[model samples]
Target: MKKFKCGVCANTVYFENFRCLNCGHALGFHPGRLEMAALAPGRDKRLREARRGPSSPMVYCANEAHGVCNWIVTSHPDSGFCDACVLNRTIPNLADPQNVRAWGDFERAKKRLIYSLLRFGLPLDGAPAGKGPLTFDFINDAVTGHLDGVITIAVGEADSVERERQRQAMDETYRSLLGHLRHESGHYYWMLLIEDTGRIDEFRHLFGDEREDYGAALERHHVQGPPPDWSLRHVSAYASSHPWEDWAETWAHYLHMVDAIDTSVAHRIEPRSTRFFSGTARAIRGQDAYRSNSFSTLIERWVPLTLALNDINRSMGHSDFYPFVIPEIAVAKLGFVHRLIRESTT
Candidate 1:
């Protein structure tokens, strides 16, 4: 996530900032401009343009009434929810106080994921006949998260303590609401970009055979554990369970690296040009990750960024923020994601 600033006060703010601390101005994220703007109150606390120009007034999404979102609807006032929230197929019954709080927690991570997706300029139109449109369902579930036509997230994942416990129970080095959303969405996109398009053969070549028996493979994985030295290529041990899983896991990791690297770029946290961290570091310099034609350079820069952040995380006595490595083969898979995303958008 890139750091945001309050346009009114020129003070550091956040994407989820509800009010500017210094200026005490109301804040809302404008998706069209991809900015967090300080609102000048209009009639009845409605938002006036913070930008110094002729402008039309804006209002927060309907979900803001519940304090569940802070995104502004830049379109018609009757649009109700922002683009992101509209994809929600089912939300927990907010009548229960626990469900209300859990739903709030879920929205924060969901918005962040959507922000990254929009910035990448990928497809967000969703699907017709329940086949294409990406939707999410937050409810009571036995699973942490799962994706079919809709992604279902267990409300318990909203609690950090509970989520961490689940992570440890599953032996995951990293897991979070955002991670769950990104990972599951990978499956949805796979259905759209690969399965529906008849490109599974190419996908199989890169990841492995998705046609392999998934349930039996998962049984073997849990019984015997990941192949020794799974990290040599797979993004996570769970990825070794099946090809479909590997693709989803890799796709999730791809989003993770890019988002962090995008943050580095936003904060101007580039490496010293005089010193190259690795052989490809020089090759990666100056590429706009959001618009770059090549994912090769993107991954090259992401490696050093991930390492630096991981070291910093250790210094703070926290686990590595990003706990996986992209070996040569893994990079090849990520490159396929890059090309696939480009293909989808264009």
Candidate 2:
């Protein structure tokens, strides 16, 4: 979330701006350079020459053709779509008009997710044969009308008003597009982790035996609520529904910790002391390599900062910004998550 400028007029811009409110310059995200570019067709014919740099070859998101996003592609990638655009398995129905607005929100949030993945050096690949590239399908029910097995994201999740209503109804503190990305990534990573012998047993022990029947577990969770003491074990009430959900929840939390700590460090918030687990907050303030660095160093910064931020959110009449408690067991699980990310990158 670094500051950006309008390449056309030099005015500052946001990551989501399509046209410079100041100069009306068409904008695109260049992933290779990790910067936004302003384009003035018929005005700035020298754009290609202006920004031809060695480190990051620049391009633009193809979705800009549809007028949905204005992010520039920083890399001269083999693929036309940027990292965020590539993950869209299903987009909303734009013909409905309202969906056009929803698509915009989805794109912004998806970009934020891409930012984190790129920052962390996660992999993004096309789906296997028959699955197609990690492509998105922005369509109405008619496109998937006959499919029973396919999961369709109700475009409504893209709507802020609708999403906020759902969040309130569910009594949750933090809900955002980035959160959804982290959660969904949990499912994606399952394919990677379940194959590993070293990590499989520990994951099973904490998340419940994945061997248990998933459909049956869902049915049971529906008919009978999670045990009243579910919080003592699971991070969220919904997580108690199944081991798969538990994994997703934990994965999302891991992203949360990593990103939060990274931002804190970027802002230069120093830790009070360097005791075990006391550095989480301080490390974030200046630690550029939050993931590869030791978790013990991070705990010092994270624990205190999480507490202070939570209190600030409550002061504003909101629920605690983070609702889950990180007990010793969860801490161990987070360590596993860190290891998994390290293993994946290596």
lDDT (Cα, tens digit) per residue for candidate 2, span 206-271: 777887898898788768867797777766776778888778777888778777766656555534
lDDT, each prediction:
0.81, 0.64
Q: Distance (Å) between predicted and true CA of 288, model 1?
A: 2.4
Give candidate 2's error at residue 113 in angstroms: 1.3
Model 2 RMSD in angstroms: 4.6
Q: Hey, what RMSD does candidate 1 come out at?
A: 2.7
Q: How accurate locally is residue 210 in candidate 1, as Cα lDDT from 0 to 100? A: 87
* Error at 251, model 1, angstroms: 0.7
lDDT of 1 by residue, 203-292 (tens): 988899888998999999988989998888788899888998899898998888788777788788855322234433242355567677
TM-scores vs. true structure, each candidate: 0.90, 0.78
Q: Which parts of model 1 have CA positions greater than 4 angstroms off? A: 75-79, 128-130, 272-286
